[model samples]
Target: MTTLLPNYLGGRWQTGTGAGSALHDPVSGQALVRVDATGLDLPAGFDFARRQGSAALQSMTYGARAALLVQIAQTLQKHRDAYYEIATANSGTVRNDSAVDIDGAIFTLGQYARWGAALGETRALRDGDAVKLDKDGLFQSQHLQVPRTGLALFINAFNFPAWGLWEKAAPALLSGMAVVVKPATATAWLTQRMVQDVVDAGILPPGALSVICGSAAGLLDNLQPFDVLSFTGSADTAALIRSHPAIARQSVRANIEADSLNSALLLPDAAPGTPAFDLLVREVVREMSVKSGQKCTAIRRIFVPQAVYGAAADAIATKLAKISTGNPRNEAVRMGALVSREQYQSVQQGLQALSTVTQVLYDGRAQPLIDADPAISACHAPVLLGARDADGAQAVHDLEIFGPVATLLPYRDLAHAQALAERGQGSLVASLYGDDAQMLADSARALARSHGRVHVVTPAVAQVHTGHGNVMPMSLHGGPGRAGGGAELGGLRALDFYHQRAAVQASPEVLQALGL
Candidate 1:
């Protein structure tokens, strides 16, 4: 029998009140589990975190909180294999992909733990140098970074259940705030199990961490002035979250990371046959297949010099042709299925939208799967589309097909490539491939205005480059405009989102007494 998924609230795991949404296994289209937050007490959960959990965390120094994070990391490491199993079965990802979510979560926790230690025993982080408040040296002013006296509510996407949870949770917990996580309903099993393990290990204080696996119907209704909410999903939903009356009335702080039309640019200097050219092809193919190209950071648009556009498109198609899409458990399958049938259908609709304007260079739905039935399973082949008249194809730049789909467009020059990239409004990341230092520098400067992170791939860094879609713990991951104007997980900077900054005007004697 498939077990009923429960919501972890008020320091205990409790089943929901009614029949919930059925989560499916993409490989076999089987019902994996059922979850719902029906009748769940949102106020009680928020109160527990605010009163009990927040106080416990607030009592600890930064060093002690860091120690707690390390302990939680160790506990999670012990269950890494179990976590991977849940990811594969529920998320329809291969072992390697599972590792990115499962193992990546553990790595993020460890990294934050290490970073928190470097902060020493100081609970309040100082913001910049102190300023003289008066003519006399005795009077001075400085800003202090202190933990917000409330709870953090995290609403994550389905693409990355594990890493998304930890990446957001680590800083919140480290900054001495409790967290209540709302994992996407499609793949909540992994998140539910992971949260259960942490709660079982007794690593976190009671009510410090809670998980709601199903509908967050009234979740936002319980928001208080001190609570911070972080959401990762579509822009439409983000707008609704922003419009919530409680949030606006109480002035609750919220951070959103939404969908974006990320791009990869190829410089004219890196024509066909060069190592940089080959590297761009390989990187695009990888991003197209990884997580079935469901990543928010995945490259949606490929910008290439007009002279080499045909060569680049052909090369990408050749590499994509070799990909084997099927059940992730199959060793020979290079790409896996989408998370669910609903998602697969959604991708089909998105593809139809793009097909209206661009020519389909490669259609995955027309291809055969290696070990699974494409019709029955959630598998789809990687589709590569070409926009010959890219300058006029506004749909190619405006619309986003959130699957193993990419649109290749031609640019007049390096400046044109940057202009086309910026035309996406704003992106989480934009990459340029070439060996010319001047071209890379100039293009990067222009692209930086619209992109959060610009990845410059040259022959030198091509061999060791982390690729264009990978989001690391030590680097900034958020972008402006359509990508969401909030930032997260930029090393120590991530802690700022969970902290309350206050400027203090006091005498030097008072500052010294307060340990500034």
Candidate 2:
């Protein structure tokens, strides 16, 4: 019998009924553990978090909460090696990719801790300076942001089980909100273990942090008006979440990150054999191979000057040809398998849809796997496709394979490239590679209307610029339209999602006495 992973809820650990769903090793297809949330008292668990958990956390000043975050970060660092083991067995990720998730989570927590400590003993945030109502300074109006007396429910995606949890949780927790995490079932082992370690350490108040590892069927249904929901998943699921009574009728706060077909463009100035061109090729390959190209911010569309179309294609393919995909445990493998057989099938179907309008530039589907059985393991090689006519390839802009797949396309000039890039409707990011400062600035402004972030890579910052698809905590992470119209993780700006903003009208003396 597979060992059942317990769900932490209502200040205690409990097991769900039945055999539960088995979590399999993506490399060897071996069942490692089971998880289930059937028959758990979700309503009571949510009530516990709202009352006891909220009170405990809200009682502390921002400095005290910052101390708690530091302790949590240290605890996770202590068990870092164990987490790497789980990532290999369950997530089928290489050491570098695992660090992107596990280490990224810890770093985000620490960054938030440092920011929170700077906030000092303030319980509420003042929006801006007070204003006089009648220009006499006798009466004033002030806007204040206070923590909502409720819990935060996070529904995360499978690709980033570690970072997805903390990136959202860190901000919410720092704002004095208790957190309930529902990690994707396929890669829930690492998340569960981290939570277990933190809970056992007894560093946090009981009911402050909880994890429900299986079906999230009833989780949203138990939310109250003051509660907040943060989700990272498919657009279809995001739609369902938005229409749910808890969000639409009860007026609960929600932040969603959904489907994005991010793009990378080579400007007219970055011709073949130039440093900017080389930088573009390196970034494309890195984005496609990292995390098996399963990131929400990964580049899906590649646009380049029509003159250097063939050269760009050849360069990118040459680099991708060297990446070996197989079992992550093997020392020689550069990339690993998809999260599960279901995701593998999804990628295959997406490739077929894209093939109707594009030709294969570099096909790795026939490449042999290393140290694994093809009949069972969920491994897949990176593939590059090309479309001669960018405007006619509607499927290329419409579909996101959620795997190691990207389509290369051509554009006439900068204007043409910007138009083609906007075909994605809206995206999390759009990166421009070039040497001309004015050209990069003009292109970034044009793309900014539709993209949440505009990443410009010039020769000056090529060595230091963070790679595309990396969601840094210092910048905004969500996008406008098809990317879910939500915003998260722009320094202290993220706290706005968990706080309630209200205007208080009072006398100058009363406002001064209130201390913002």
The candidate that wins on TM-score is 2
Q: How many collisions per candidate?
A: 0, 0
Task: For candidate 1, give the lDDT of residue 68.
Answer: 94
lDDT of 2: 0.92
Q: Write the per-residue lDDT of candidate 2 for residues 53-157, one digit (tens) a residue.
A: 878999998888888999999999999999999999998998999999999999999999999999998888899988889778888898999999999999999
Candidate 1 lDDT, 1-516, residue by residue in tens: 577988889988888888888888898988888998888888988999999998899888888899999998999899988888888889999998888888888899999999989888876888887889788777899888899999999999999999999999999999999999999999999999999989989888998999998886888899998899999999899989889986778889999898799999888888899998998999999999999998999999998888887888789988898988898888998898899888889988888887778998877666778778766788878999998888888887887778899999998877677778888888899988889999889988998899889999998986688778988888899999988877999898999999999988888777766664
Clashes of 2: 0
Best by lDDT: 2
TM-scores, all candidates, are 0.98, 0.99
lDDT of each: 0.89, 0.92
After superposing all C-alphas onto the true structure, candidate 2 shows an RMSD in angstroms of 0.9
